[model samples]
Target: MDTFRKFALNIAVFISFFSGLNAQQTYFEGVYSEKKIIINNPLSADLFGTCIHRITINGEIYPFNISDNYLEVDLSLLSIRKGELFSMTIDHESGCVPIIYNKNDFKFKEGVKFISLKADGNKLSWQSQSEVLLSSLLLELKFRDKWVKIAEISSNGMGNQNYEYIVPFLLSGKNQFRISKSNTKQYYYFPVIDMTEQHYKIASNSVTKHINIIKNNKPAVTCYELKDLHGVIVKKGIDGTIDVSNLKNGFYKLYFDTKEEVIIKK
Candidate 1:
């Protein structure tokens, strides 16, 4: 049974009174997944064939069928994507607000847990307690002020599972790491990890021949990348000196170790 990547379907019912005769609203919010979820009588209580005035899903009215005072909710009829915000409001008699019977199914499954995420050397490792079958987990690292997917791992879906991925190199300063199932918004964010060791300096912001990096007031060899204003990497390597003479005269981003600088070729 290949289940979904652990998403939540929330159920909330708040009744408002309007002289005890007006329609009340019930709301449901959650993150959607691909797993086929067909919950019969999700409200647990049978609704009167005509008591339900209207039902809306994601701000749109939802069509439903009622037979023998029973309302069936089949979400598969809609084109909902994973991590998409799902909200539903039902307008009905204030005396009869539908209650969710399967609210437990709208939360993380039993034993599915996010233990810890850590980075060691050039590798990142994390663990989780999982259900029987789950999708692969994504590894995202904050790079250049953006979250970039560096690696991914197929989860074991076992009890107390461990996973690891080797990174090419660390960002060289304060950076963040996280893991997620499918949605980028839904993730386990780790604490900031500072890899900055000694202070580094650029010899010149406007270069004519070469760019020299100084660490602790001395020439330092480090991994560096040079990108144009359009974010195109023009040059990258590991050296204490970068020959920018070949680069066109323009503004360029310099990523030296953990520090970033802007340089002009003049």
Candidate 2:
């Protein structure tokens, strides 16, 4: 009788522990093959009856209803290319919105392509091949002097994969150019003057060219070739100007004769 009682107590303890675990946020990692979709509640507690939920894609929000164990989210709503990063959020019992899943680990296949950024006056237009309805789409804009962000608008999926996005205003100065994207973390510094005309030109010459060393007026310790490094070697008295027009956009460390300078080739 004592052994039977002990067994019952052990089972009770196990059940209690299991229930506690289910009440917390869980991280799930998996891949969807053959277009198979799996929908699971992110909340620790069981969702009973009808629950209202929102689906955000690229920055647009769509409302949906959760009834059974599976929430059938239409893949067509995603308009995802072969290997694009897709994410969704869920409302929890604590009233905190949490990211349920993101395709950060997925890679695009051959036929998948994303809409490139188009420059428009002070705004950017992003068009996709499929219509995406989302709760929010974060926009990150880069300027010559500083970076600014603006939440423009939201809309429902009209079964078309095109979207027109516009930035609020220019950052501040005259030489400032803006590049924008949906992801706030990613930064693009390319110079875009107009989007309506799709005219994007490199801002190489626009960058201030000056030599900055550890000691501005000190003697050189070592001599290295500037061309050897990843920068265009614009000789002091060469043709028209330092033909860095071909250099890819980014920060490059340039060494002139014995003086080393950092050049931002945007």
Candidate 3:
């Protein structure tokens, strides 16, 4: 089938699916929250680019640019109520795409919850009260036009999900850290301190997961943590060796105190 025909068929099928859904169920109520609309069998970025020209939610149309895999939209102005049938149509230059998603696909949470945050010299720590797994907490600095993530720490499981991170070099004045659950929109951010003096040395072999850490006169913590790019904890230790023998070949960070070393596992 031609590209236009395939797109038309998809939209038709999508609309038909939603038309049959129970009219009592409404997905996008007029609640003010950031929600992600994940597309099924998503089109290639190369083909559609990042922005969608227009989005028809119910009968209202809005324009938005998708920055990543899913389209992020605000559900504040949408008149649709919960327990009612909800449908959206996205118009692109190539084709008009329609999608019907259940509540399971759209991820959203209402307001922000406060986390206990503190800074002690080059270290930062925070705690969560809920017994829910959260995404890795990321140390980030504003760079150019975007916030560049410097390091990640896992926040999985429940109870007092506390974490401590040492600050590396502050690349920019605007620095903040954030933590989130894997798929939910609930994220917590903490402001970071930009330090001028180096308190410790964090070095490691570029090819292996072994890291060498040394603290000067500062009272540094003995334990260390390992996290992937997404802030997921791979491993942690309090002993001498920071091992990554089981981890696959990828870039990782070994964090301790206010120091972090990048490790490229081979």
Q: Report, for every candidate in turn, its global Cα lDDT versus the true structure.
A: 0.63, 0.38, 0.51
Which candidate, 1 or 3, would have the higher TM-score against the true structure? 1
Q: Candidate 1 lDDT (Cα, whole model)?
A: 0.63
Error of 3 at 1 (Å): 69
Point to the candidate with the largest TM-score: 1
User: RMSD to native for every prediction?
Assistant: 14.0, 17.6, 18.0
lDDT of 1 by residue, 41-124 (tens): 333223334445555677544554422145555454566654344666666655555655555444434234577877776677
lDDT of 2 by residue, 145-241 (tens): 2343445345333234544654433322232333223433433343455323112112232344432222234322212223424445443321112
Residue 217 Cα positional deviation in candidate 3, in Å, after optimal superposition? 20
Task: Please say which candidate is ahead in lDDT: 1 or 3.
Answer: 1
Candidate 3 clashing pairs, residues 3+ apart or interchain: 24-83, 25-83, 25-84, 26-83, 26-84, 135-180, 166-257, 166-258, 167-258
Give the alpha carbon lDDT tens digit for every residue of 1-266 in model 3: 25534554465555444332221222243222235454432343346443233456766553343334355554444544332244655544333233435445443332223478766665777776643343454555444344445666666444445677776544323345565544455666666655454455554456455555545644333346778999887876443456567788988877654456778888
Better of 1 and 2 by lDDT: 1
Off by over 4 Å in 1: 1-112, 132-134, 198-249, 261-266
Candidate 3 stretches greater than 4 Å from native: 1-114, 172-174, 197-266
Cα distance off (Å), candidate 2, residue 82:
9.9
